[model samples]
Target: MPYINIKITREGVTAEQKARLIAGATQLLVDVLGKNPATTVVVIDEVDTDNWGIAGEQVTRRRERGR
Candidate 1:
């Protein structure tokens, strides 16, 4: 079995976005990686601003500054 994990830190992640991302990722593994979707597992983790950093700064701070 194939296990896939996708971690993203951002606001406003819709159901459609998750579906598309999973589909695309699965397709990539199936087509490019020569894996089977039936045996592949995809997991998405949505993290808060504090869990992610950008430019050596925390995203929560940027959002506070409206940047």
Candidate 2:
């Protein structure tokens, strides 16, 4: 079994997009590592922009600054 964890900012991601991400991640494991799709697990975590940071700045602040 292969487990994949995906984390992203909670920025209006649609269910269809999340489904595509899951499928793509599952396919990647199947293609590269020959993992069984039935056994592969993909988890996505959406965090608030205020909780996500880069360059010592919160993502919310960066977006506000247009950076």
Candidate 3:
């Protein structure tokens, strides 16, 4: 079994987009690793910008500075 974890900022991602991400990850394992789709697991984690950070700053602050 293959376990894939995906994390993204919780910025109003649509259900369809999440579904596509899961499907794409599963398909990638199936295509590249020859893993069974039924045995593949994909988890999507949506985190608040404040909880996610980059370059010594929170994502929320980064976005604010960019704007």
Candidate 4:
């Protein structure tokens, strides 16, 4: 079994998009490593922008700067 964890900012991500992500990740593992899709596990975690940081700046602040 393969476990894939994906983390992203808590932006407005649609359910369809998340479904696509899960399917795509499972397919990638199947194609690349011959893993069984039935046994693969994919988990997505959505974090607050304030909790995610880059280059010492919070993602929330970074987006604020861009706006």
Candidate 5:
């Protein structure tokens, strides 16, 4: 089994983004990694803003408020 794991920021995450991510990942696995797209598995994880930070600043609270 070919497993693909993806992690993205909580901001601006959408279904179309997820689909495009999956498609691009699948293509990379097939074309570059030489994996079979048929047997490949893709997993996308939307990480909480607080769970990540930039410039040592937390954005979890901001993300929750926006939601």
Candidate 6:
């Protein structure tokens, strides 16, 4: 079994895109490692901009600055 965790900023990701991500991740494991799709686990975590930070600033502020 393979466990994969994917984290992304919750800005404008659509359900279709997320579905593609899950499917693609599962297929990657199946194609590259011969893992069973049924046994593969993929979890997507969306973090709020306020909760995510980088370069000593929150993601919300960074986006506001447009840098």
Summed backbone clashes in each candidate are 0, 0, 0, 0, 1, 0
lDDT of 3 by residue, 1-67 (tens): 9999999999999999999999999999999989999989999999999999888889999889883
lDDT of each residue in 1-67, candidate 2, tens digit only: 9999999999999999999999999999999989999999999999999999999989999999887
Best model per TM-score: 2
In the range 9-48, model 6's lDDT, one tens digit per residue, is 8999999999999999999999999999998999999999
Model 1 TM-score, 2 decimals: 0.83
Candidate 3, residue 20: Cα displacement in angstroms equals 0.4
lDDT of 1 by residue, 3-55 (tens): 88999986899999999998998899988879979988899999999989999
lDDT (C-alpha) at residue 65 in model 5? 61
5 or 6: which has the higher lDDT? 6
**10 residues in a row with least lDDT, candidate 4:** 58-67
Clashing pairs in 3: none
Ranking by TM-score: 2, 4, 3, 6, 1, 5
Residue 65 error for model 4, in Å?
Answer: 0.9
Instruction: Indicate which candidate wins on lDDT.
Output: 2
Q: What is the TM-score of each candidate against the true structure?
A: 0.83, 0.97, 0.95, 0.96, 0.73, 0.91
Question: What order do candidates take by lDDT, descending?
Answer: 2, 4, 3, 6, 1, 5
The digit string of per-residue lDDT tens for model 4 on 1-67 reads 8999999999999999999999999999999999999999999999999999989989999998893
lDDT of 6 at 14: 94
How far residue 46's Cα lies from its native spot in candidate 3, in Å, is: 0.4
